[model samples]
Target: MRVSREQVTANREQIVVNAAEQFRRRGFGDVTIADVMKAAGLTHGGFYGYFDSKQALEAAVCERGLAESVAAVDAVRDGEGGEGTAAEAPLRRFVDDYVSARHRDAPEEGCTVAALACDAGRSGPELQQLFVSGITGMAGSLAGLRGQGSAEPAEDGGPDFATLSTMVGAVILSRAVAAADPELSERILAAARERASAPVE
Candidate 1:
């Protein structure tokens, strides 16, 4: 039977979502089209119907994950407000969520930057571009938060690049060393949480 266009779109989105989860959990090189299809509960042959190539699927995945990450950060903005350290409460909550043991152990649901930046660097231009856009969106959402309180925007009006770097880098380092030294992993998150959530100067 022929499938409806809506069904096809839903199926394609399902495949991308599953692929994103699997790729984040297993890494790009370790995942395959068949694996993504299987994770999506669709037949392997149907993969070509949705995407032209694994890279295409990855681009879609990155798009979805990055958008969600930015949205998650944007959601925190509604919670902004308090005096003193309390003023940083919203971003602090976000930082804690991003740099926690739960996030470290759950790559499939974590930040795309932390999970796939290294792979994207080698994956080719299209994927790299998606990473760039995604990272920019993330930073934009974060930059929006700074505008909420007394902290004025930097001349560039960009996200606090240092804090963004620390947040992503901390997760990456913590995950990288997690298998070898669990203590270090927790400490890494702790240090990053402190820095990433600190009140702006």
Candidate 2:
């Protein structure tokens, strides 16, 4: 009953994808390897076949989540008439998606940085590095929207890191009280959008 290499790769990817979504929904400490394995439709005994340990799986999950987030931003940029399109078009798309109600309600498929930042502080270095890379990628994406080749300083004094942090922080705050304070949640997103879209000063 040996599996083919293709199937094995699919299984491993499935495990990572599912684990990433679950980790974003539930903190790392709250999720167990057995739980992830069961959710992935594989037996607990087979978990080790794909990942050496839960920590390794966490790292993989973080990697996958971060890649997806950056890809999402890149897709928006690519759609906006290649590199010559107005930077504001991609920037608006990024802000809209980042603070949207759909994103706020969908933790399993949303940005991992906003979903798992608190947990990342207590996690191992692998997950921490993944978080840092994701944040940097996001900042770079926003910087690109400004026609900058890198996340270097803008002549207008707008910092990409500041924009990235503000967006992530807004989402975090929006989600924190979304259930009990729906109006505040909506306002949070709207306010963040307005601020993010304003001219960087």
Candidate 3:
């Protein structure tokens, strides 16, 4: 039977969403189109109707994943109330949550920015662009947290690139290391959080 346009659109979106989750959980190279179709509850034969190839799907998934990651950060920021601006609150929460063992064990719901970066580096140019954009967006979110209490000019400065890089790196490393030694993970996570939450001066 022929599917309605709306149904096709919905199915395509569902496929992308499912693919994003799977990709985040199992890396891009590790997941096949058949796996994605299975996760989306669609037949493998129907994959072509929605995407030209796995690369196309990867691009779409990257966009969806990045969007979800941004939303998660926004939710944490929103939960903080107006006591602080969107930029700082979210980054603080992100730093805390990202480095935790909870995030390490639950790859399906973890930060897409960190989960997909390594895989994206080996993907096609289009996929790399998506990854780059996602990283830029994440950095912008973190930079928003700076100077909330200080009288310093907002435009004059923000979280340095090195600082943000260290934060993200620390989370990824802590999670990886935590798998082998729980205490080491906790120590690294604590140090990373302290650095992220430290004063601008």
lDDT of 3 by residue, 147-183 (tens): 3333222244643454456666776777677768978
- Those runs of model 1 whose alpha carbons end farther than 4 Å from true positions after fitting are 80-88, 149-156
Q: Given candidate 2, what's the lDDT at residue 157? A: 45
Best by TM-score: 1
Residue pair clashes in candidate 3: 87-144, 87-145, 88-145
Better model by lDDT: candidate 2 vs candidate 3 = 2
lDDT per residue as tens, model 1, 1-201: 999999999999899889888989988999999898888889999999988888888888988888877778887777632222554556666777888888889999888888988888888897888878888887877777666654444337776677788889999899899999999999999999887776666
lDDT of 2 by residue, 61-84 (tens): 788788877887777767742332
Sorted by lDDT, highest first, which candidate order results? 1, 2, 3
| TM value for model 2 | 0.87
Alpha-carbon lDDT of model 1: 0.82
Runs of candidate 2 with Cα error greater than 4 angstroms are 80-88, 148-159
Name the candidate that leads on lDDT.
Answer: 1
lDDT, model 2, position 31: 89
